[model samples]
Target chain A: MSDSKAIFLKDAAVNAADGDQRAFIRKALGGYYVNRDLQKARYRDWERARDAASLAKWSAVNDLAAVLEQFVANFERNGGVVHWARDAAEARDIILKIAADNQAKAIVKSKCMTSEEIHLNDALEKAGYGVVESDLGEFIQQLRGEAPYHFVFPCMHVKREAISELFTKHLGTAPTDSPEELTMIARRHLRQLYVDADIGITGANFLVAETGQISITENEGNARLTAALPRIHVALSGIEKVVRHLDDLSVLLPMLATAGAGQPMTCYNTLYSGPRKEGECDGPEQFHLVLLDNSRTRLLADPEQRDALHCIRCGACLNVCPIFKNIGGLAYGTTYQGPIGSVITPHLRGLKQWNHLSGASSLCGACTDACPVRIDLHHHLLHNRRNAAKEAPTLFDRVFHHGFNFVIKRPWLFAAGGRIFRATLPLLQKLPLPYMGAWMKTRDLPEAPARSFRDQWKNPDA
Target chain B: MPDARSDIFARIREALKVKAPRPHLKGEPVAGKTSAAAKPWLPDGGESAEASLAILAEQLAKLKAMLIRVPDHASAAKAVAELAAAKNWKKVAYHGHPLLRPVAAALPCEAWEADASFEKQRLEGCDAGLTTCESIVAQLGAILVSSASSGGRALSILPHAHVVVAEAAQVVPDLGSALALAKARHGDQMPSMLSFITGPSRTGDIERILVLGAHGPKELYLVLVG
Candidate 1:
């Protein structure tokens, strides 16, 4: 096993058994379930809505090259600069150069998982530039010196007392256990950052091809502030974020909110066509869009799993996934953590090392049911398993299959083996079988039948 | 050296040679056979204007945004003044529009109009922001605020509370109509910033508990005038 796989195994074992943490997550998501059902009831036909949402995104992914070129042309015409980064290193370098060119003194950012995926903050910090997370959840995680516990609800697992303590220690605020009070503390603290920050960084939820716009969905409005105040605005996003048309948001925005957080719409779903127009009141003077591929095209190369690009990042699949609920988000040990993550991580990173994720699913298909864009998440897990085995079949794999094939090919040999098993079942149960200790630890051998099924079928009267 | 853009596009083109199967929606048309105008499956917005307004009120109430209706522009101003006095707003920021200018002038508290580009620090000091919206969607209680209509981006978001002044004629049935309105008005010159304000800014980030204000507008009100 790879080092990441080992750490993942160890963490999954520990976190799954953390009953208290599991209960907390379950109770927290209970409200989400109720709210989602309530909002979903408002839909004329929720399943049909999913069909449309899926088709809208598929329209973009199906003709990606042409649509991307069109988006770039329109975005440039709207007075925004576009930079294409083939990988993470190039992306970071491009951003750093932009910050240097602008002589940026202060930088504030909203919640962007793409940035987290590329480890952008560490790159910026190592280069001696200060960056602050303006989103309330991101701000808390930043002060705690941790990655997000969950992407959408970044610090969901944290208790109130710990947050109060964190606030007291970091912001020098009075201790308070009230969630609203803790929120206000972060709000009051970050208010100044938005005003004073010289440059702002954000992530695009969707990039519109026909309109050349980027839509950002947020509940807290930090993204709006990030785009509004700074003289220079830089956005980092995955290449798969582009969708075909502006009207597609009409179907997508409501579904994203109802599925993501159980609301009609998030408080802010803003679209930016470009930097501040010549006669507009106030916005960033310069807008720079950095498009990062970073091995996404690898996943795209396999046509069977290309629909994985249809993911809107709603994080719904994570909510319903049994493994995610038990082991929690951090145990996945990937930037994305859940069924969707399990399906695509191998492709994004590498099948050999990350294939362990594929093995962890229960294959209940709850994720497929919950997915807004209909990615076929559970089957992709099976695909990864097949692909991984094809790539590197181990000694054990060869022996098990070869042995089974040899016995099954000969009916007489199979029947003899079965008769021997029936005769020695009791003795076999008592044996401390080599290579089967872990499998037998909590399970018992089944009772063997008196006659083979073939013999019974041949002598029906007897 | 080939550009990263070309290289990425090249790979995508190669991958598209094999097509994936269409979604398994029973009775759904095959790929490339679906209608050009995709129908939304959202909540029903009533056919008539009055019925739409009723739906808007119900939706807004559920979303925690208060919608105040008045007979005319003068009554709208009176409502704003009353709200200012009731809430004891220290100062407010507003856009410079005919519909809102009189209301801004009549505010019980000091009002600053951001008609042109302005400083961020001053707007940040205000207790509330009042702006005119492009349209309001009745299907979902969404306010479409563009930079052209809403006094840029900062006015709506920077303050502690946001109050939007809109005419009843601006009310539309659904989200699609709102998008069509923007496209019809702007054409290729899309506004740099166009946002759909759903309710007061909120977050359920802390232990999944709802908090009214996380970064912007703890309170949101819509003063709808006929």
Candidate 2:
């Protein structure tokens, strides 16, 4: 087994038994499920809306090169600078160079998972920049010196008492159990940093081709201030974020809200065309958009699973995945978690090392049903498993299959083995037998089937 | 390194050769095959203006946003004065706009205009921010505010409470129309920033529990005048 897969098994076992962690995930997601259904009903037709949303992303992703080229031209025309990074290292260097050129002292950021994917915070902090996460969950996670527990709800696993303790240790604020009060503590703290920071970094939810604007959707308004207060604004986005037109957002944004968060609309969905234009009141003076490919083109190369790139990062799949609900996000150990992550991690990382993620599923279609853009998630996992076996089947896999084939080819040997297995079935079931024991813990070896298929065929109605 | 721009494009070009089709549109891998819906996929505000207004009010109520309607601009100003007196606002921040200047003037407290350029600290210190919006959406009770129209981005977002003053004519039925309106208003000179604000700043981040005013205004009031 791969190193990542081993870590995943160990973590999954521990987390699945963590009563406190399980309760937090269940309670939080219970609310999300209720709200999502209620808000979904607000749509004229939810399934039809899903199809429309899917096509909107499909059109952009299928015609990716054209739409991206158009977007780049229009964005540059809008007086914003565009930087293309081939991989994570290049993306990190590009952002560092931008900061150095701007002579930035401090940086504030809204929640951008792409940044996390490239480890931008670590890169920037190593280069002697004080980077602060402005999104409340991200802020808490940052203060705790941890990765986001969940991508969207960054610190979902943390209790309020723990959060209060974290704040007291870090920010030196009075301890409070109130979620609202804890939010105010961060708000009060980040306000000054926003004013002082020379650079603000953010993530783009959708990059509109026609208008050349990046739309950022968030429930809190931190993204607004992060983009507004800083003199230099830098946004990092994956190349797959492009949508065909401004009107596409009109369809995509509502579904993202309802499916992801169960809201009529998130509190803020802002479009940024450029730096503060001439004759504008206040905004960043220089706008830089870094478009990172970072092996996404590799995923794009696989036509069978190409629509996985259509993910809006609304995280609806993560919310509904039974595996995610049980094992939690940390165990996945990828930048993205849940079904979407499992389907694409092999493509984004590598097939051999990450293929175990595909096996982690129960072939449940909850994620496919929950996806706003209708990426065939479960089928993609199956494809990953097949491709992995074809590409590099382990020696154990080969030997086991060979042994089974050798026995099955000889009818007498197979019959003898079956007779022995049936006779010892009760003992085998009772004994704790390593791998077989684990398997049989949740399953039963069906009552020895009374007689074998050959015996049943020989007798008329045995 | 290796001309990232052209290289990335080359990879994309090569990748796009083998087209992937949506399940329903399998023959030739149709680009932009938008499914024609029998009814509008999103909630709609009927054909009439009154219908739009009624839906907008109901949506706003659900969002916990206060919507104030007035017969005229003078009543709008009076409403602001009364709200300030009731809330006991110490200082208010606003930008120079014909629609909202009077409302700011009636604040009966230190009113600061964040004009073309202003200090961030001054805006941050204000109790409430009053600004003009480009358009309001009735479908989701979303207010579309642009940097050019709303005295820049900070005025609508920086303060404790954001009270937007809009005319009834500015109300649109849906988000798509709101974007169309922006396109008509700005053409190529689009505002550096355009934000669709649904409710006050909020987060369900902490334990996935709802909490308002995470990093922006806690209270949001929309004052509409006819």
Candidate 3:
């Protein structure tokens, strides 16, 4: 491991342990497992629903992509301008330009990972606009000036005492550790910002092409205000988020619930198309959908890896990763984190810069099994490792793989090498171990067998 | 800007490629994939008057909304007058829906239409707000909010206490039925926002401790008028 990554992993390991990381992780996992099964049954009932009217209403799922295009077309037809961004930088620029055009002084944002990836709030603030994260987890992380740690729960890493300290220091309050009271304090503080925001930015969970609608699913109602209260509302999302029809969303909706929070659905599943109607009382006059590609086009180019595009960012892969449980999202050193991050980061940013992440895994195959749509993550990780070896191998790793390949390809040489390796066990143990030993410090290493089966078979008579 | 125009077209072309029509469709609409095994399910907008009222009550309870069974518009108006007088409320807004006119007239404060320009004023100054419900879902006790003449996005959102007046006839079985009604009412075009409000606005953002009324209404009230 690189020195920087090694240090990050060590620090995260300590923090996760100190914060009862194992118990927390286990709790999340247990919630997901139970919710997954319950949702599975719920989806089956939804699927088996027999009423003709109901069936026709839900057929949108089968035609999701088509529906999304229709939605885009309809939104455009309705004077709601739509912009497509191929990456985070482009998405940021699109939003920044919109804010500039509107001469926005302040922005109130809801729960949008796309905005987080683009660092939209910081970008706007750098341009001298005040940006507020209206979502509760987002608000907490905004105060801390830290990246969000969870998909649904951003400030999961923070304890009540820490928040009490943050509030006491920032808002000038007596240090009190009650979550309920702290929430009330935050509510009071954020209410002013919500009303005062000039622009609002959000992310779409799904875009129904058929109806020209952006669907936002949330338990908290902040997104409603974020879109409605501001003079301008901007929604940023990936290209793959489009479903041909809204009915197709039926199949995908339950999948998202199971994969996301393990609930049947969030409390709010809102769909917004364009600006307010002529007679409407309140809503933004302008709406913008910034469809981002990032490196997704490249991902779509490869059929084997294209399924990565199907990720709803439900974060099931991250929740189930053994590596992530120990080191946490920060150790990954990328916007997207955990097992999915390890696979997609190098691909998005390029293998040359982030090749080491592909080697970080033990290939336990937990991520693939945990994926709701069944993304074969372990195989993809291995493929990434192979590609990294070819595209950007270090001198030492190259030599190791080259030599290892030579021996493994030749059975006779491999058998002799195995014997030699057995003979040098004492010497190998006596010599000071390296980073692998560091890994072994936390985990138990299995002992070598007494003899190779081939050797034992050869000497059977004796 | 280059990414915006080109990428969209590129994605559109790719999508078209996937959905391209084929001769082998055999009237199946695609590359000969069989018709979906079963038809898609849509919501049926069927409910008895009794069931509808029951659903409205249940939804009100779920939202923690105050439910008062008032005899007519006069009594409902009286209740509002009492509330405004009791709380020392400064300003209030009411939707233009026919059902809400009496309540608006009864209130001591002036009422304005749902205008985006007045959102900040309504949000900050309004002590109580009222709107007519487009529909209500029985299963989750959720109220369907749409931007109609009398039902602005802000009516249910901006006020400290949002009072939604529901008729016994407007309740449905679930979200599917509500969405179907929405689609039928608005055509293929979705409104700027359709809030499925189940209860008062709340959040657990600070540290997973539930706090009621973050940026939206701190309190919700449902007036079930027969």
A1-462 per-residue lDDT for model 1 (tens digits): 798899998898899879999999999999999999999999888888888889888888878888899899999999999999989999999999999998897899999999998899999999888999999888888999988877788888888999999999988999998999899889988999999998899999999888899999999999999999999999999989998777788888999998988898899999998999977889999999999998888888788999999999999999899999999888888888899889878887888889999988999999999998888999999999888878998776789878989999999899889989899998988888867844575688998888888989999777
Docking class of 3: acceptable
| Docking category of candidate 2 | medium
TM-score of each: 0.96, 0.96, 0.81
RMSD of 1: 2.2
TM-score of chain B of each: 0.93, 0.92, 0.73
In model 1, pairs of residues that clash are none
lDDT of 1 by residue, B129-218 (tens): 999999999988999999999988899999999999888999999887888789889988999999999999999998898999889899
- The interface root mean square deviation of candidate 2 comes to 2.0
True contacts kept of each: 0.75, 0.78, 0.37
* TM-score for chain A, candidates 1 onward in order: 0.95, 0.95, 0.88
Clashes of 2: 0
Highest DockQ, which number? 2
Worst 10 residues of 2 chain A by lDDT: A433-442
lDDT of 1 at B172: 92
After superposition, which runs of candidate 1 have C-alpha atoms over 4 Å from their true positions?
A422-425, A431-462, B24-40
Off by over 4 Å in 3: A1-69, A251-258, A359-366, A394-405, A408-411, A435-437, A443-448, A454-462, B1-4, B11-92, B102-119, B167-169, B218-226
